[model samples]
Target: MSSTPANPPTALHEVWLIRHGETQWSLSGQHTGSTDIALTDHGRAQARALAPRLATQSFDAVWSSPMARAIETCELAGLGGQRVIVQDLHEWDYGIYEGRTTPEIRASVPGWSVWDSPVPKGESLLQIQARAEAVVARLLAASGRVAIFSHAHFLRALAGCWMGGAAALGAHLYLDTASISLLGFDHESRAIRRWNS
Candidate 1:
Protein backbone atom coordinates (compact mmCIF):
# COMPACT_ATOMS: atom_id res chain seq x y z
CA MET A 1 0.00 0.00 0.00
CA SER A 2 1.23 3.46 -0.83
CA SER A 3 1.68 5.66 2.19
CA THR A 4 1.40 9.44 2.44
CA PRO A 5 3.56 11.49 4.77
CA ALA A 6 1.64 12.23 7.89
CA ASN A 7 0.66 15.82 8.52
CA PRO A 8 3.38 17.57 10.48
CA PRO A 9 0.60 18.79 12.81
CA THR A 10 2.26 22.21 12.79
CA ALA A 11 4.92 24.04 10.85
CA LEU A 12 8.39 23.65 12.24
CA HIS A 13 8.27 27.37 13.04
CA GLU A 14 5.75 30.03 14.02
CA VAL A 15 5.96 33.79 14.20
CA TRP A 16 4.58 35.63 17.19
CA LEU A 17 4.27 39.26 16.24
CA ILE A 18 3.15 41.50 19.06
CA ARG A 19 2.14 45.12 18.62
CA HIS A 20 3.81 47.43 21.11
CA GLY A 21 1.76 48.50 24.08
CA GLU A 22 -0.35 51.65 24.12
CA THR A 23 1.13 55.12 23.85
CA GLN A 24 -0.49 58.40 24.89
CA TRP A 25 -1.80 58.83 21.37
CA SER A 26 -3.24 55.33 21.27
CA LEU A 27 -5.26 55.89 24.45
CA SER A 28 -6.65 59.06 22.96
CA GLY A 29 -7.47 57.60 19.52
CA GLN A 30 -4.96 59.75 17.70
CA HIS A 31 -3.04 58.73 14.62
CA THR A 32 0.49 58.11 15.82
CA GLY A 33 2.77 57.66 12.88
CA SER A 34 6.52 57.97 12.44
CA THR A 35 6.65 60.38 15.37
CA ASP A 36 9.08 59.30 18.07
CA ILE A 37 7.22 58.97 21.33
CA ALA A 38 7.67 57.27 24.66
CA LEU A 39 5.37 54.81 26.34
CA THR A 40 3.10 56.00 29.08
CA ASP A 41 3.66 54.63 32.59
CA HIS A 42 0.84 52.16 32.08
CA GLY A 43 2.33 51.27 28.71
CA ARG A 44 5.62 50.51 30.45
CA ALA A 45 3.84 48.27 32.89
CA GLN A 46 2.20 46.39 30.05
CA ALA A 47 5.56 45.81 28.44
CA ARG A 48 6.98 44.62 31.75
CA ALA A 49 4.15 42.19 32.15
CA LEU A 50 4.86 40.80 28.69
CA ALA A 51 8.29 39.69 29.88
CA PRO A 52 7.06 36.47 31.43
CA ARG A 53 4.88 35.69 28.47
CA LEU A 54 7.79 36.22 26.11
CA ALA A 55 10.05 34.01 28.19
CA THR A 56 7.66 31.18 27.60
CA GLN A 57 8.38 31.18 23.87
CA SER A 58 11.77 31.02 22.21
CA PHE A 59 12.09 32.90 18.97
CA ASP A 60 14.69 32.36 16.30
CA ALA A 61 14.60 36.06 15.55
CA VAL A 62 13.43 39.04 17.58
CA TRP A 63 12.72 42.24 15.67
CA SER A 64 11.46 45.67 16.60
CA SER A 65 10.63 48.96 15.01
CA PRO A 66 13.44 51.49 15.37
CA MET A 67 10.89 53.68 17.07
CA ALA A 68 11.53 54.14 20.78
CA ARG A 69 8.18 52.80 21.87
CA ALA A 70 8.56 49.50 20.07
CA ILE A 71 12.19 49.03 21.04
CA GLU A 72 11.36 49.83 24.62
CA THR A 73 8.63 47.23 24.57
CA CYS A 74 11.01 44.61 23.24
CA GLU A 75 13.52 45.40 25.96
CA LEU A 76 11.01 45.51 28.77
CA ALA A 77 9.61 42.23 27.53
CA GLY A 78 13.11 40.79 28.12
CA LEU A 79 13.86 40.44 24.41
CA GLY A 80 16.48 43.12 23.94
CA GLY A 81 19.44 40.84 23.30
CA GLN A 82 18.95 39.86 19.66
CA ARG A 83 16.65 42.62 18.55
CA VAL A 84 16.96 43.62 14.91
CA ILE A 85 15.62 46.92 13.66
CA VAL A 86 13.34 46.74 10.64
CA GLN A 87 12.48 50.14 9.19
CA ASP A 88 9.77 48.75 6.96
CA LEU A 89 7.86 47.75 10.06
CA HIS A 90 7.56 51.30 11.33
CA GLU A 91 4.07 52.74 11.75
CA TRP A 92 2.21 54.42 8.92
CA ASP A 93 3.32 58.03 8.68
CA TYR A 94 0.17 59.91 9.61
CA GLY A 95 1.68 63.17 8.40
CA ILE A 96 -0.67 66.10 8.83
CA TYR A 97 -3.10 63.88 10.66
CA GLU A 98 -0.61 63.00 13.36
CA GLY A 99 -2.11 63.19 16.83
CA ARG A 100 -5.58 63.93 15.49
CA THR A 101 -8.78 62.00 16.02
CA THR A 102 -10.76 60.56 13.09
CA PRO A 103 -13.69 62.85 13.71
CA GLU A 104 -11.39 65.83 13.37
CA ILE A 105 -10.10 64.62 10.05
CA ARG A 106 -13.62 63.86 8.86
CA ALA A 107 -14.62 67.35 9.85
CA SER A 108 -12.27 68.72 7.22
CA VAL A 109 -12.08 65.98 4.56
CA PRO A 110 -15.70 64.88 4.67
CA GLY A 111 -15.87 61.08 4.11
CA TRP A 112 -12.16 60.71 3.68
CA SER A 113 -10.79 57.29 4.56
CA VAL A 114 -7.23 57.02 5.71
CA TRP A 115 -7.05 54.02 3.39
CA ASP A 116 -8.26 56.08 0.45
CA SER A 117 -7.15 59.59 1.34
CA PRO A 118 -3.51 60.45 1.22
CA VAL A 119 -2.07 61.85 4.42
CA PRO A 120 -0.05 64.94 3.67
CA LYS A 121 3.69 64.19 3.75
CA GLY A 122 3.24 60.51 4.49
CA GLU A 123 3.77 57.30 2.57
CA SER A 124 0.67 56.09 0.79
CA LEU A 125 -1.00 52.77 1.60
CA LEU A 126 0.55 51.19 -1.48
CA GLN A 127 4.02 52.11 -0.29
CA ILE A 128 3.38 50.78 3.18
CA GLN A 129 1.78 47.62 1.85
CA ALA A 130 4.71 46.90 -0.42
CA ARG A 131 7.12 47.24 2.46
CA ALA A 132 5.06 44.80 4.50
CA GLU A 133 5.00 42.20 1.73
CA ALA A 134 8.76 42.40 1.50
CA VAL A 135 9.06 41.70 5.20
CA VAL A 136 6.75 38.71 4.98
CA ALA A 137 8.61 37.35 1.97
CA ARG A 138 11.83 37.62 3.95
CA LEU A 139 10.31 35.80 6.89
CA LEU A 140 8.93 33.01 4.76
CA ALA A 141 12.39 32.42 3.35
CA ALA A 142 13.93 32.27 6.81
CA SER A 143 13.92 29.07 8.83
CA GLY A 144 12.51 29.63 12.26
CA ARG A 145 9.99 31.29 14.51
CA VAL A 146 10.24 35.06 15.02
CA ALA A 147 9.10 37.79 17.38
CA ILE A 148 8.34 41.27 16.06
CA PHE A 149 7.45 44.30 18.13
CA SER A 150 5.93 47.24 16.32
CA HIS A 151 3.29 49.96 16.18
CA ALA A 152 -0.42 49.81 15.41
CA HIS A 153 -1.15 51.19 11.94
CA PHE A 154 1.85 49.61 10.28
CA LEU A 155 1.31 46.33 12.01
CA ARG A 156 -2.25 46.34 10.77
CA ALA A 157 -0.95 47.08 7.32
CA LEU A 158 1.58 44.28 7.70
CA ALA A 159 -1.23 41.91 8.53
CA GLY A 160 -2.89 42.81 5.26
CA CYS A 161 0.30 42.29 3.31
CA TRP A 162 0.71 38.92 4.96
CA MET A 163 -2.71 37.84 3.79
CA GLY A 164 -2.01 38.84 0.17
CA GLY A 165 -2.94 42.42 -0.77
CA ALA A 166 -4.94 45.52 0.00
CA ALA A 167 -3.26 47.05 3.02
CA ALA A 168 -6.30 49.24 3.46
CA LEU A 169 -8.00 46.31 5.17
CA GLY A 170 -5.54 46.81 7.99
CA ALA A 171 -7.71 49.66 9.12
CA HIS A 172 -10.11 47.03 10.44
CA LEU A 173 -7.78 44.95 12.60
CA TYR A 174 -7.69 46.25 16.15
CA LEU A 175 -4.63 45.39 18.21
CA ASP A 176 -4.00 45.86 21.89
CA THR A 177 -0.61 46.75 23.27
CA ALA A 178 1.33 43.84 24.71
CA SER A 179 -1.17 41.58 23.03
CA ILE A 180 0.03 38.53 21.14
CA SER A 181 -0.89 37.49 17.58
CA LEU A 182 0.15 34.54 15.44
CA LEU A 183 0.69 33.79 11.75
CA GLY A 184 1.47 30.39 10.30
CA PHE A 185 0.92 27.89 7.52
CA ASP A 186 -2.38 26.20 7.03
CA HIS A 187 -2.65 23.50 4.42
CA GLU A 188 0.58 24.36 2.67
CA SER A 189 -0.28 28.06 2.43
CA ARG A 190 -0.11 31.26 4.42
CA ALA A 191 -3.07 31.95 6.66
CA ILE A 192 -3.73 34.54 9.36
CA ARG A 193 -4.26 31.64 11.79
CA ARG A 194 -5.07 34.26 14.39
CA TRP A 195 -5.22 38.03 14.50
CA ASN A 196 -5.13 40.74 17.23
CA SER A 197 -5.38 37.68 19.33
Candidate 2:
Protein backbone atom coordinates (compact mmCIF):
# COMPACT_ATOMS: atom_id res chain seq x y z
CA MET A 1 0.00 0.00 0.00
CA SER A 2 1.17 3.54 -0.71
CA SER A 3 2.00 5.48 2.41
CA THR A 4 0.70 8.95 3.07
CA PRO A 5 3.15 11.74 2.18
CA ALA A 6 4.83 13.90 4.78
CA ASN A 7 4.77 17.67 4.95
CA PRO A 8 6.51 19.55 2.11
CA PRO A 9 10.20 20.45 1.94
CA THR A 10 9.69 24.09 1.06
CA ALA A 11 11.18 26.68 3.43
CA LEU A 12 8.99 27.16 6.47
CA HIS A 13 6.02 29.19 5.42
CA GLU A 14 3.94 30.67 8.19
CA VAL A 15 0.83 28.60 8.97
CA TRP A 16 -1.98 30.20 10.91
CA LEU A 17 -4.06 27.54 12.62
CA ILE A 18 -7.25 28.92 14.09
CA ARG A 19 -9.87 27.22 16.23
CA HIS A 20 -13.40 28.41 15.73
CA GLY A 21 -15.17 30.54 18.33
CA GLU A 22 -17.64 29.77 21.10
CA THR A 23 -20.46 27.35 20.56
CA GLN A 24 -23.03 26.12 23.06
CA TRP A 25 -21.29 22.77 23.16
CA SER A 26 -17.82 24.30 23.35
CA LEU A 27 -18.75 26.54 26.28
CA SER A 28 -20.16 23.51 28.06
CA GLY A 29 -16.97 21.51 27.49
CA GLN A 30 -18.57 19.00 25.17
CA HIS A 31 -16.68 16.97 22.57
CA THR A 32 -17.46 18.71 19.29
CA GLY A 33 -16.74 16.92 16.05
CA SER A 34 -18.72 16.13 12.94
CA THR A 35 -21.60 18.09 14.38
CA ASP A 36 -22.72 20.91 12.16
CA ILE A 37 -23.42 23.47 14.83
CA ALA A 38 -23.33 27.25 14.63
CA LEU A 39 -21.46 29.59 16.87
CA THR A 40 -23.16 31.51 19.62
CA ASP A 41 -23.81 35.24 19.23
CA HIS A 42 -20.65 35.97 21.18
CA GLY A 43 -18.79 33.56 19.01
CA ARG A 44 -19.39 35.85 16.08
CA ALA A 45 -17.95 38.75 18.05
CA GLN A 46 -14.88 36.77 18.94
CA ALA A 47 -14.31 35.79 15.33
CA ARG A 48 -14.71 39.41 14.19
CA ALA A 49 -11.96 40.50 16.55
CA LEU A 50 -9.60 38.45 14.45
CA ALA A 51 -10.13 40.72 11.44
CA PRO A 52 -7.78 43.40 12.74
CA ARG A 53 -5.34 40.84 14.03
CA LEU A 54 -5.07 39.29 10.56
CA ALA A 55 -5.58 42.31 8.31
CA THR A 56 -1.87 43.01 8.14
CA GLN A 57 -0.81 39.47 7.34
CA SER A 58 -1.01 38.28 3.77
CA PHE A 59 -2.07 34.67 3.40
CA ASP A 60 -1.44 32.64 0.26
CA ALA A 61 -4.35 30.34 0.94
CA VAL A 62 -7.16 29.95 3.45
CA TRP A 63 -8.86 26.63 4.17
CA SER A 64 -11.74 25.76 6.48
CA SER A 65 -13.87 22.76 7.29
CA PRO A 66 -17.26 22.59 5.64
CA MET A 67 -18.79 22.75 9.11
CA ALA A 68 -20.70 25.92 9.84
CA ARG A 69 -18.73 26.81 12.93
CA ALA A 70 -15.45 26.81 11.01
CA ILE A 71 -16.73 28.30 7.80
CA GLU A 72 -18.48 31.09 9.64
CA THR A 73 -15.31 31.88 11.49
CA CYS A 74 -13.43 32.42 8.25
CA GLU A 75 -16.18 34.65 6.97
CA LEU A 76 -16.31 36.69 10.16
CA ALA A 77 -12.54 36.95 10.23
CA GLY A 78 -12.64 38.49 6.76
CA LEU A 79 -11.24 35.59 4.78
CA GLY A 80 -14.24 34.48 2.75
CA GLY A 81 -12.78 35.21 -0.66
CA GLN A 82 -9.64 33.24 -0.04
CA ARG A 83 -11.29 30.33 1.71
CA VAL A 84 -11.53 26.79 0.38
CA ILE A 85 -13.32 23.90 2.02
CA VAL A 86 -11.23 20.82 2.71
CA GLN A 87 -12.80 17.66 4.18
CA ASP A 88 -9.50 16.64 5.69
CA LEU A 89 -9.77 19.66 7.96
CA HIS A 90 -13.01 18.47 9.54
CA GLU A 91 -13.22 17.98 13.28
CA TRP A 92 -12.78 14.57 14.87
CA ASP A 93 -15.78 12.32 14.45
CA TYR A 94 -17.16 11.91 17.96
CA GLY A 95 -19.37 9.01 16.88
CA ILE A 96 -21.64 7.91 19.73
CA TYR A 97 -20.70 10.91 21.79
CA GLU A 98 -21.10 13.44 19.03
CA GLY A 99 -22.42 16.13 21.36
CA ARG A 100 -21.44 14.74 24.75
CA THR A 101 -18.83 15.86 27.29
CA THR A 102 -15.92 14.09 28.92
CA PRO A 103 -17.55 14.00 32.32
CA GLU A 104 -20.58 12.29 30.87
CA ILE A 105 -18.52 9.75 29.01
CA ARG A 106 -16.50 9.13 32.14
CA ALA A 107 -19.59 8.23 34.10
CA SER A 108 -19.76 4.97 32.24
CA VAL A 109 -16.06 4.45 31.66
CA PRO A 110 -14.24 5.88 34.66
CA GLY A 111 -11.19 8.02 33.95
CA TRP A 112 -12.07 7.84 30.31
CA SER A 113 -9.68 10.10 28.53
CA VAL A 114 -9.96 10.45 24.81
CA TRP A 115 -6.25 9.92 24.66
CA ASP A 116 -6.65 6.75 26.67
CA SER A 117 -10.09 5.60 25.59
CA PRO A 118 -11.60 4.90 22.24
CA VAL A 119 -14.31 7.31 21.08
CA PRO A 120 -16.88 4.47 20.97
CA LYS A 121 -17.06 4.25 17.19
CA GLY A 122 -15.37 7.50 16.24
CA GLU A 123 -12.10 8.12 14.45
CA SER A 124 -9.04 6.59 16.02
CA LEU A 125 -5.89 8.59 16.67
CA LEU A 126 -4.23 7.11 13.64
CA GLN A 127 -7.30 7.84 11.54
CA ILE A 128 -7.29 11.46 12.58
CA GLN A 129 -3.57 11.57 11.90
CA ALA A 130 -4.22 10.38 8.38
CA ARG A 131 -6.53 13.31 7.84
CA ALA A 132 -3.97 15.72 9.23
CA GLU A 133 -1.31 14.15 7.07
CA ALA A 134 -3.35 14.74 3.93
CA VAL A 135 -3.80 18.43 4.69
CA VAL A 136 -0.11 18.87 5.39
CA ALA A 137 0.70 17.06 2.17
CA ARG A 138 -1.47 19.50 0.24
CA LEU A 139 0.31 22.44 1.78
CA LEU A 140 3.70 20.90 1.11
CA ALA A 141 3.07 20.86 -2.62
CA ALA A 142 2.96 24.64 -2.56
CA SER A 143 5.06 27.45 -1.15
CA GLY A 144 3.24 30.18 0.69
CA ARG A 145 1.80 31.02 4.07
CA VAL A 146 -1.61 29.45 4.69
CA ALA A 147 -4.40 29.90 7.20
CA ILE A 148 -6.45 26.95 8.41
CA PHE A 149 -9.75 27.45 10.16
CA SER A 150 -10.74 24.33 12.05
CA HIS A 151 -11.66 22.86 15.42
CA ALA A 152 -9.86 22.05 18.68
CA HIS A 153 -8.97 18.38 18.66
CA PHE A 154 -8.19 18.22 14.95
CA LEU A 155 -5.96 21.27 15.05
CA ARG A 156 -4.20 19.98 18.11
CA ALA A 157 -3.58 16.68 16.39
CA LEU A 158 -2.26 18.50 13.36
CA ALA A 159 0.24 20.34 15.51
CA GLY A 160 1.43 17.07 16.97
CA CYS A 161 1.67 15.44 13.55
CA TRP A 162 3.52 18.44 12.13
CA MET A 163 6.18 18.17 14.82
CA GLY A 164 6.74 14.46 14.17
CA GLY A 165 5.01 13.68 17.41
CA ALA A 166 2.52 10.91 17.98
CA ALA A 167 -1.17 11.71 17.42
CA ALA A 168 -1.86 11.23 21.13
CA LEU A 169 0.41 14.20 21.78
CA GLY A 170 -2.52 16.30 20.63
CA ALA A 171 -3.90 15.86 24.11
CA HIS A 172 -1.04 17.97 25.42
CA LEU A 173 -2.04 21.06 23.44
CA TYR A 174 -5.01 23.23 24.34
CA LEU A 175 -6.93 25.76 22.24
CA ASP A 176 -9.60 28.39 22.74
CA THR A 177 -12.21 29.55 20.28
CA ALA A 178 -11.00 31.97 17.62
CA SER A 179 -7.51 31.52 19.02
CA ILE A 180 -4.70 31.83 16.49
CA SER A 181 -1.64 29.58 16.47
CA LEU A 182 1.53 29.71 14.40
CA LEU A 183 3.32 26.79 12.78
CA GLY A 184 6.45 27.03 10.66
CA PHE A 185 9.93 25.68 10.17
CA ASP A 186 12.79 26.27 12.55
CA HIS A 187 16.15 26.19 10.77
CA GLU A 188 16.14 22.80 8.99
CA SER A 189 13.04 21.39 10.67
CA ARG A 190 9.29 21.89 10.87
CA ALA A 191 8.05 22.97 14.27
CA ILE A 192 5.09 24.46 16.03
CA ARG A 193 5.87 28.12 16.65
CA ARG A 194 3.31 28.33 19.45
CA TRP A 195 0.53 26.21 20.81
CA ASN A 196 -2.87 27.34 22.06
CA SER A 197 -2.94 30.54 24.04
Each prediction's TM-score versus the true structure: 0.90, 0.93
Per-residue lDDT tens digits of candidate 1, residues 1-197?
11111223153367787888778988898888877888999999999999988898878899899999999999999999989998877888888888899999999899877788878887788888888878877776665678999987777787776665658778778788778888766655565777876
Q: Go through the candidates in order and give the clash count of each.
A: 0, 0
Residue by residue across 110-142, what tens digits does model 2's lDDT show?
A: 998777578778988889888887777777675
User: How much is the lDDT of residue 78 in candidate 2?
Assistant: 96
Query: How much is 148 displaced in model 1, in angstroms?
Result: 0.6
- What lDDT, from 0 to 1, does candidate 1 have? 0.80
Determine which window of 10 residues in candidate 1 has minimal summed lDDT: 1-10
Report every candidate's CA lDDT.
0.80, 0.85
